[model samples]
Target: MEQELKAHLKKLMASGDVAGIIALKSERGMAKPYLFADASELECLCLTPKYPMASVARLLLDEDGAARFAIVCRGCDERALRELAKRHQVDLDRLVIVGIPCDEEMARECACPEPFPSVVAVGTKLEQWEAEDIGAAYRAMELDEKLAFWKHQLEKCNKCYGCRNACPMCFCKDCELENALWVKHGRLPPEFPIYHMIRAFHLAGKCIACGECQRACPSDIPLMVLNTLLREDMEELFGYVSGTGADAENPLYTKEEMQ
Candidate 1:
């Protein structure tokens, strides 16, 4: 399957299906985004230590929309790209998805519900994941306990923008978090529940459970608890799952929500 992917990428590059292929290349022993133009460069491609290649796609497409490009997408990357397209952050028409199914270990590490992309171009799909009771257990807590949990977690925040920067869905040019009025500039803790709540609410209809935000947090905050709760809320209120489909409408943005 590894050879199959290498051959496929070579074909895509040679045949001009993609002017450039956005894939990971080995650099300093780390896998990072590298644009493939030559078939010989395909030898450098690697996919481990997963970075958000879709986020890289978002940036590249902005610069060269007319050029065709292909990206190596895991399930999370594909879904993130779909949601980004919904916001006009990415032009899907100019891109190709070379989907790669994640292994079971990666699936559990990500806590991903859907670990397989809609299509797979390389590797056999892993069907099972070890489900975590993160959301359900947190939901089972008493109101006071829940409050304490959040307060404790949020107390560790240093006001770094790691979470937002890592998120592929969070594409605001001028973030409200930067505005002194919303997040305030008083102290180390920032604005506490309000600061985090604003971000949580903003991600209501957009978060795809990729766990990038959680991974980027320096404070080891259980941000996934907040996201998983919101995911549940979105599903219950509108039967909406973020990144489920490219064409699915975000109810939060619908005109009817205003009324």
Candidate 2:
């Protein structure tokens, strides 16, 4: 896939299909976004330790077509970009996607249901990861046991907002978490279940299950498992999938859409 990716980069660069490729460049010991124009730099492109590459591209591209580029997208990145575009965060027409499908190992590591983007330019698109509903097991326990289990997990939260920070879909100029009235600032744990419930309800049909929140958590919380369940609930309720299309109805607009 590396060789194929390099070849595609070269082709894109030579044909002036993009201004530059927004991809991960290994620097020192970190893999972060860098504009890769020269095909030689594709050798240093790192696939592991994924960042929200789509967000990087969103910030780089202009809203009025002032800049154009091709991005190296995984399934999550591609889906996130689609979602962002729907929200007017990015201009999709000005960008091209050079998709790199995750192999089995990376797919399993991310625990992603859709490991491959719609555009399969390079690499083999492995089957979706079969994720376990860890929440379901907790739900099956007795009421008291379930309460205790959630209390224990919720107690560990330091109110860092790492989950919101890592989430690509969480783009709001004014967030409820930041409001002193809703969340009461300067309080750790932030009222436990309500604190977490606010985020859970907000992300129901919006989260793409990228696992970025879990990665960013210092406390090693399995936030993605909770998000997966939310996604499932949304699908069951409204029959919608996040980032599937620009015109796709979101659960947030359910009332308006039903009119």
Candidate 3:
């Protein structure tokens, strides 16, 4: 699929359709995201474990040097951009999507049914994954159990802020997490579930389940599960999926839109 995608990208570039292609490359110990400009750079375009290429797409768009760009996307990333486009944060018409399908193993790892992008280069399309009640298990646990679980988990936090920083949909100019009132300054471990819950609540309707938050967590908390579960509730109760349509408004802030 990488070769096929490379060929497609090469064709697009040959036609001067895009200025650059943002994809992943296997380097050092892990797969890292990179932008490939010349055709020769496609050899480095590897597809693998790392994902949520939407943030990289946003980064490329922010660069004044990048006029048009293409990104290899999974279902989650594609959905993220769909929502972002509605906010006028992205110009989808000027961007290209190279779809990559998810295999059974990958889908199981993510507990994802809709693993592949709706649009992509090559692969067998599978049935959309239903959003499961993963949180029921979490919710079933006793409050003390949940608190202890999070306490242990939060102890492992390095205070890197990578989870917040790596999110594509988290574009607040004034992030509440940083406010001294909400989260005290210079506090390590950050006062447990408050920090985590605050972030999760903020992402209630907007999180695209990209799993970047979990990947970014040096502590390896299953943060995506909580956020994704809340996202499901938002979808069910409000009829809003974060990255579905260009104009799909989140009901939380748009009380008028809800009416």
Candidate 4:
């Protein structure tokens, strides 16, 4: 699969469709995102150890508006890119996506439902996995029980901001989390459910369910449970599934407001 993807990327570069190709390059034993402009460098290209390629792409695009690139994207990566484009953080017209389908094992690891992008350039597309609803138990709990659960989970927070830093969707320059009026500086655990509730409300129609927040949290807080529950509620209430496409209007606002 790696070889096939490498070959496809080389062809794309050779065709002069993009200035470079953004994909993971293996150096020694580490894999990181690298822009491959020369076909010779394709030999070092790898597909493991997923980094936030969408975030990297946004940075590159911001640095050079005229530059065009092709990105090797998994399902989540593509979705993130679409979300960024919708928010005017990226110009999708300047991008050529090279889609790669995720295997079942990778799907299970991330608890991802759709493991493949819109188009597959390499690797066989696998069937979508039935992701376990991680919020089931929490949703089943009574009102007081739910409060107790959140208190226990949120109390472990050390105000590390790992979850915020790792989230691809958290690109606001003036973040509500950092505002002293809301979260209060120099305070641990962040004022009960205030910090987390604000975050969840903000992400109601925007979270792509990449699981980066939960993975980055050192406190082992099951952040995805809250995110997943909100995601479902957004879909049910507004008929909006975030990151699916760039053109879809956010149902949280009116058409006039969007303009």
**Weakest 10 consecutive residues, lDDT, candidate 1?**
125-134
Q: Point out the higher-scoring one by TM-score: 3 or 4.
A: 4
TM-score of each: 0.96, 0.90, 0.88, 0.95
Which RMSD does model 4 reach against the true structure? 2.1
Writing each residue's lDDT as its tens digit, candidate 4 over 1-259 gives 9988888888899999899999999999999889898999999999998677898899889998698999999998899899888889889999999999888887877888588889999998886468877778888999999999999999999989898888888899999999999999999878998999998888888788888888899999999889999989878877789888667867775555321
Candidate 2 residue pairs in backbone clash: none
**Residue pairs in clash, model 3:** 99-120, 113-129, 114-129
Per-residue accuracy of model 1 over 1-259 as CA lDDT, tens digit each: 6678999888878787779999899877777788888888888888888788889999998888499899999998998999999998998998899999888888888888788799998888986565575799888899999899899999999988899999988889999988888888867887679889999999998998889989999999989889989988999999899988777888998877532
* Residue 253, model 2, lDDT: 59
Better of 1 and 3 by lDDT: 1
Give the candidate number with the greatest TM-score. 1
Lowest summed lDDT across 10 adjacent residues in model 2 is found at 126-135
Deviation in Å, model 1, residue 227 alpha carbon: 0.5
Candidate number that wins on lDDT, 3 or 4: 4
Clashing pairs for model 4 are none
| lDDT scores in order | 0.87, 0.81, 0.79, 0.88
Question: Residue 60, candidate 2: how far off, in angstroms?
Answer: 1.5
- Give a tens-digit lDDT track for model 3, residues 137-217: 887899899888878887777678899998888877899888988888898878776788889998888888777788788
